[model samples]
Target: MKPGTFLKSTALLDGTFFERSVIFIVEYNDKGAMGFVINNPFPRKLNELEEFKHIIPFPLYLGGPVDQEHLYFVHRRPDLIEGGTPVDAGILLGGDFKAAVKHIDEHTLTGNDIRIFIGYCGWDDGELDAEIAEGSWEVLEGGMLL
Candidate 1:
C-alpha cells in the first residue's frame, strides 16, 4: 500500500476498533504506516471543544484510536491552505493551521475542501503488511478520495 490508498476493514476485524472502517493512508514506507479512518465521524463539532471554542463550528471525525487530544486534517486546498504535505494527486495532510482558520472564517474553506480529524491510526514497521496478508483489510484503488 502507498499514500492515498484506502484500506477497507474486512469482517475479520468485526467488533474491533477497525470494524467496518475505511482508512485513508497518508504515509506508508519501510519505517511505518499511518492513516485516518475516513468513514467514522465523531459526534462533536469543533466549537464544543475548549481549545477550539473560538473557532467556527466544524464537523469533526474520529480518525482512529490514537492521539485523541490533538487535531489532524486532510485537505485538497494546498494552494489556499499552504504548507500541506501531499498524500497523492491534490490531497494533502496537515498545513498552516492559522491560514486554515482564517480561510475557514472568511468562508474560503468549506467542509468540501477539508476534513478534520481527532487522532489517527498507525502501524509500526511491517504490522500493516501482516494485517493485510491476514485479510484484515481490503485495499481500494483508483481516483481521488477526499
Candidate 2:
C-alpha cells in the first residue's frame, strides 16, 4: 500500500503482535515496506523521558515488534524539522528530533502536532504482498491520524 495509508490487522493476525493493530504506512516501495502502529500506545509519554522532560507530554505508541530501543515519529510540520521524508500529501515521516523538541518548547508545536512511536514494522520485498493476499491486513485510507 502507499505511504500514509493504513493497515488494519485482520482476524488472521489474532493473538499475534499485530492483532487489532492499526499501522501507519511510512514507507512503501520496491525495496520493502516500513511503518509504525498508531493505535497500540505504550504506557508512557515522551515528557516522562529525562532527555525530553522539557518538551510537551505526548503518548508514545508501540510502533511494532522490532528494534524496541529505537524511536521514530511522523509529522506534518516539515517546515520545522529538516530531513523529513514525505509519506503522503501533507504528511511526512521522520525528521530532526532536536529541532522538533525545540519547536515544541517554544510553543510552536504541541502533542497534537505529531505522533511519536517506538520501534517499527518492516517487511521484505513481496512478503507484505503475500500477507495481504492471505488476508492478514486490510488497507485503509488515512484518517485524522495521518
Q: In terms of lDDT, which candidate is strongest?
A: 1
- Window of ten residues with lowest summed lDDT in model 2: 137-146
Give residue 137's lDDT in candidate 2 (0 to 100). 93
What is the per-residue lDDT of model 2 for residues 1-146, given as tens digits with 9 covering 90 to 100?
67888889999999999999998888888999998999988898888988888776767889999898988988889888899888887777889988987887787866677788889999998888899999999988657674
Q: How close is candidate 2 to the true structure, as a TM-score?
A: 0.92
**Which candidate number has the best TM-score?**
1
- Kindly give the stretch of ten consecutive residues in candidate 1 with the minimal lDDT sum: 137-146
- Give the residue spans of candidate 2 off by over 4 A: none
Quickly count the clashes in candidate 2: 0
Clashing pairs in 1: none
Off by over 4 Å in 1: none
Query: In candidate 1, what are the lDDT values of residues 1-146, reduced to their tens digit?
Result: 78999999999999999999999999999999999998888999977888668878888899999999899999999888879998987899999987887887678999889999999999999999999999999988774556
